[model samples]
Target chain A: MAREASVSEVLLDARGIAKSFGGVQALRDVSLTIGRGEIYGLIGPNGAGKTTFFNVLTGLYSADSGEVQFDGARLDIGLPHLVTRQGIARTFQNIRLFANMSALENVMVGRHLRSHASVIGAVLRNRATRREEADIVDRAHRLLRYVGVDARANDLARHLSYGDQRRLEIARALATEPKLLALDEPAAGMNATETASLRQLVESIRADGVTVLLIEHDVKLVMGLCDRVAVLDYGEKIAEDVPDRVQRDPKVVEAYLGGALA
Target chain B: MTTLEGKRRDPRVALAGTLLLAVALALAPFAVGAGAGIAWVRVIDFALLYIMLALGLNIVVGFAGLLDLGYIAFYAVGAYLYALLSSPHLAGAFPSLAPGLHWPIWAILPLGALVAGAFGVILGAPTLRLRGDYLAIVTLGFGEIIRIFMNNLNRPVNLTNGPQGITQIDPIGIGGVSFGRTLDVFGIGLPSVYLYYYLFLGATLLVVFVSIRLEDSRIGRAWVAIREDEIAAKACGINTRNIKLLAFAMGASFGGVAGGLFAGFQQFVSPESFTLMESVMVLCMVVLGGMGHIPGVIFGGILLTLLPEALRYGAGPVQTALFGKVLVPPESLRMLLFGLALILVMLYRPAGLWPSAIRRREFAGAGNSPENGAGSERE
Candidate 1:
């Protein structure tokens, strides 16, 4: 399959990544590269270890044997916060906003790594910390507005509607100012209208210069949005190419439609 | 627009209410006569101390959502630190150290808080990964360990004086204004209790202000995020390990400061004072007030502290009026009434007397969307 035009400069390189959970070989010899500013799609049927790969990339899990390089340095595995500090941010398959916190506060949490206000600073509310705090609030508001949830900025995150919640999650992720943004099932349970807006949101995120790695079950959305797509089946990469070619790949068709249908 | 108007009006009303409450608290001693004033001051002193403890525990259990059952251990550490640094009893054990040179109370207070905070870090470092009941059990064990050591640590050198505890502890004072003695303020001869009442009031207010600042800060949001979902919090670039330890240490520092104040007021330090019941009572204050909400915790602390004593005083009159003589003793009746009050509060207001806005919404069932995964995925 031919490479997409935007896939020239690699941003995230994973080579020979493998993982096993006790007796279950969850992933074996899986590898993929995401180019800078490219909308990369990772698509597979259920139980194809898509989430497992995401977990390994985000440092929630350690690959049994492999290496992941992000921004030209070896990415540390098994320390999720460190991975985030290294400029990789992610949203969960299930929305995990701080339910009790206001939407603005939820986004400010993403600025945790960026802001250096100490405990003493927080308690004292000194000039510098106050300035930093004001900046955080302003930036958080801007992020909310960008994600189309600024109207509910003061509302508790859990109180937001489903589409608003999804947008708020995206806003929180963006607040971290990551070099790479990984989103898992951003359009899950969304209506057609919501999905259309989400598409615009994803494009805007990429337009803001953040590399996007998306895991989605919506084939049409992936095919339309991703610059390059990787298809996984039985814990191994079957095809890696432009969306159209990956969709037409014989192995991908057999994996999804079954050998009889293919 | 109606909701916006209501939201805009809330802070003004809350501010005015807070001012009213502050004025009432300041004049409370004078509202009662001299004889009753002293007694009320003493009760208020203890209540303020409990409020400080509750606020500290709220950082760990409320904001960070870490269940710490051994929080009293830090209090004990602070109390004993103050006792050791300022008491003459230590002079007898370490003659060369010149323990007779008691540090000033103001100086020792911060020292006590620091020492207690250090111990908190020590306790938290190893237990950062533990959560819920497991974390609680470990903390419970830590509390028992501290108590057991204080009870039997007279070996080799007699450090803590074993179960007899430390006495002749120096009282807190500044220059000529000693809290242990009556002071003439503005031509009025104020009682020692009055001085302590004012001091405790100031300390309680400081703690409340700090708690409020913390609740509104970025770190506070990170703490709430950690509480909601640790994995998500980490993915958001929050160092969960350091934040959890910070919560423990910060909470312990408050406990420590209160313990120092406790030592100064009581002029004694004993293992019996720091018990599992004290930790549970402080926790009850946080829960009954409202977890993660500062004002709710304050209300909880005051109500729980005063209710038992109030019931004790009422029981005597209650018994005398009901049976012409003492039918049931005041102590037994007081306990029964206290238990009944707590049960009633829990049954009627499960979220708390004054729950945080979020908790109030939760209890009202305002934000439960099935697609949001509100129920199944909560940590």
Candidate 2:
């Protein structure tokens, strides 16, 4: 279903990325090329370095030796906010909404980079600042509605239902207007129905022209939803292909079963 | 929680409330007889000054969620700047160093604020990576270091006049109207204390207005987001380092303005005035009143400032009536009761005496499951 994206221009190219913590090598020479508008999936067993790679791409962790290019520009992978400014936004493995802020506020914070109101403007609240502020609110409300969580726009993020919180997180990420939106285990705690809705939402996001990079342990959903699947085993990419082929690859099967059996 | 179109109240109601508050403030200093009215007004003036300081600290501690223990350093900077610029002590010591700057109050206020804001940035830069307790410790040390500098800088140079502090500092005035003298207005004589009271009140209101504006601005939202989760805030494209520095600079500027006002009002400033206790008291005001709520913080500032003085007067009389004599020194008893009141307020109103609406909701829903009470079931 997502194969058309594979034929499009490449959007994010992370090359030979490696990261380690003390004695543990979290990632080793992992590389990926996600086409524009692709819903790419990364799956692995426990400690397989899926999240490590995600963090590196999103600027939470600086790679020991690597290079990432977004929209054909060399991405400096040191500061997370800079990574976001370069048009990549991400959600955490555990949902990390500004827990105490209202859902609307969480989305507005995502608009931080997009809006340009300085201290002087805010203090004086002149016409331009007021208009920008109003526009921010309008767009935030629209994003909340886009994610189907507008009704809970005023509720604190922590007080939202688990699935709605996930959706709200998506709304926040979307508010950044990123070319690439990365989700880390977005469906980790969702039920079947919740997962279905989340899948539809991810599709609609891709349909809206934003590329998505998904990291999940839920192989079934990934295999069904993603255009191409990459499987990691013990911090190494074991397979990369269409989902059917990646699923059939013996090394991929062995890595998953081996970890489960062990 | 403060959306641009969140809620609207009637303008008439708001105007009425403002008028009532203004009238109350205007008439408050005269409540006591003329004999004791000056002292009472002085206490209120100090309370207003403290309110400005608390509002400044709230920008850092409440809005940005930075635990600043050395915030008094900025206040000291402002005070000392005003002292050096406006007092003749510098001329007495140096004689040839331009015969004492004696800069005007208007000029000194902005200079004080700018210098204090610079100090704030200096402190904020090194502590960007620190969180909570560690940040508090560093700030506390910073506060003490500034005090120790002021206390000892008198040696070989006599910049601050050592432990004695600066004296004969010019009182704040504008356009030939000296605030240091009583003025007759509309057939009523307003004392110097009353004049200063009005000045402090105006400054306090300005600070409150600026605080409210910043509270709902883009920068304010960034601060709250950083406070909530630094990592998430970064992912949302907020430059946490710069924003944190901004919080410090903005907060410290307020302290600086308050410090200038304080120095001008008292006509003296010493290292003793900028102690660690003052910083803690300001923090307490932010917490006890309502961490991020403007009115709560103002109330907290006023309450904490006036409470000790009130206790000083009432403690001795109460002890004499109850124990047939004053058992503990009134000073000690005042602090003891003050401590007891803080503990009780913390125990009962854990959120604060008056918290922001969101904080109130959080406290109200404390024991409920995250997804239970205010949330819809999973779809």
Candidate 3:
């Protein structure tokens, strides 16, 4: 059954985004736009630099040329917190949940964006400080519940099962209240059962009004779930369209099958 | 102790604990043994002071996951500020803030905190940009910088009395009564040492209470988030730079307050007191207790301090009876044993002797399962 997606507005718009490591070109002349409440999947063959594109977008690596504009604001370099405050959040391909922290702590970190105590207030322990701190703890738990981990709220993040950890990572990301949530391989290590759950979770997130950028290797999952598909090959966009169109594009086929996909 | 039960417990437990701690602190100086009642009182006073230092360092190294090797620099600045302004040596040099309004400790302490906080800000400003080993090296360098400046500035005529040190410093005055002077009570004069010891204990408890409360707060959560994963913390809009500086300044000021007390208590202080070794000692307390754990740090500070003194006085009679020697000979083997202990402990208990519950759960959870395994039934 096909569920109707809400109006899709241009949520993220990038133009001529270029990045290099020394003389090695990682991303060059890349341009793409993601719509509000849209699920976009990015796929490419090994060494095609999809991860590099993720890095540049999240401010882990700076782009050498062009601009990244999200919600009408140009992205700046080296200020990840600002990117976050601007309503953009992401998870790592390798799962970078705070391993030593509880699932609750990881989410509280995301909610830290809303706190407003100057350094002085923290030390003074005034009335406002107390109120702000209590609110953070309360909201952090709410976020935990929203992501379906309220029961295991106090459990260490690393201790969670593989699938649950991925869910918690999403919760932690959502704690930031981002307009767009970027998941770098949310289904990377999951089995089929986990992937099915992830598909449902993605739909649920989009239902909540957040646009999602999913980087997935599972072709079936990507084709079935994504509203739009963008394929990259050798640091250049080879195709961007509906899943069926992306699948038939000869350039995408050559990039994936090294000749022509079935 | 109720806080140990987690934040969901009764609020009265916390409030009662605070009141009980306040009462106990106020009574400690009057019931001591061994050293002069005065000296023992000062020892407890310093113990409370060290507790504050440990609690603050816990935030930077304990909560935030940042390794700071030079936390004593802020302490040195607070000590020197009080020493330079309130002492007789300054009277001869330039008597403006010097002889410092004879301001009460209640007044001097906050000013001391601000002065130390500002120093923390200054040090954190340029150095907070560095992370991991680089940050450690930079902090280490800053510690040395403050130490060297203190030492060098003391020479050539002497605003700081050169290495001669400063003296005739006044103790805190409350209302109209000076704490440094003894008081009349029930036909007997209670000593000033008792007064200061209790006051210091109160301050230590205050810092500890605030620190534990703050750890679970938004800022507290942010510090741990940054510690666990920097890129993620910022992605959450944590303002990593500001949080890091908050940790730095908060940690430093506690040590600074300790320094101020040292100046006032000893009534004499010099550049020699705030050395790089001082920084190492404070770090040892935090590490030995458990980084990022408050009670562990306080315990660490007290135990580490009392151990050496115990060895000195404790072994004296035994050594004299056995080898016809005093307890500790010149140059104790403590340094060797200290390093050996750290290595042994790290091998066995990297989570710390008494780590904060969250830290223990985080690190220990790696191998063991919770009583109910990590994954719920999802029912």
Best by lDDT: 2
Give the runs in model 3 whose Cα sits over 4 Å from its true position. Answer: A1-8, A118-135, A259-262, B1-24, B34-38, B95-104, B155-157, B323-348, B367-379
Q: Model 1, range A164-218, lDDT digits (tens) per residue?
A: 9988998999999999999998999999999999999999999989999999999
Q: Please report, as a residue range, the 10-residue window in candidate 2 chain A with the lowest summed lDDT.
A: A1-10
TM-score of chain A of each: 0.97, 0.96, 0.92
**Please, what are the lDDT tens digits per residue for candidate 3 over residues B280-313?**
7788888878887778898988877765655555
Candidate 3 interface RMS? 4.5
> Of the true contacts between chains A and B, what fraction does model 3 have?
0.67
Candidate 3 chain A weakest ten by summed lDDT:
A1-10
Q: Which regions of candidate 1 are displaced past 4 Å? A: A1-6, A260-262, B1-23, B33-37, B98-101, B366-379
* Cα RMSD of predicted structure 1: 2.9
Residue B350, candidate 2: alpha-carbon lDDT:
81
Q: Arrange candidates, best TM-score first.
A: 2, 1, 3
TM-score of chain A, predicted model 1, versus the true chain A, to 2 decimals: 0.97
lDDT value for model 1: 0.87
Question: All candidates' TM-scores?
Answer: 0.94, 0.95, 0.90
Winner of 2 and 3 under TM-score:
2
Better by TM-score, candidate 3 or 1: 1
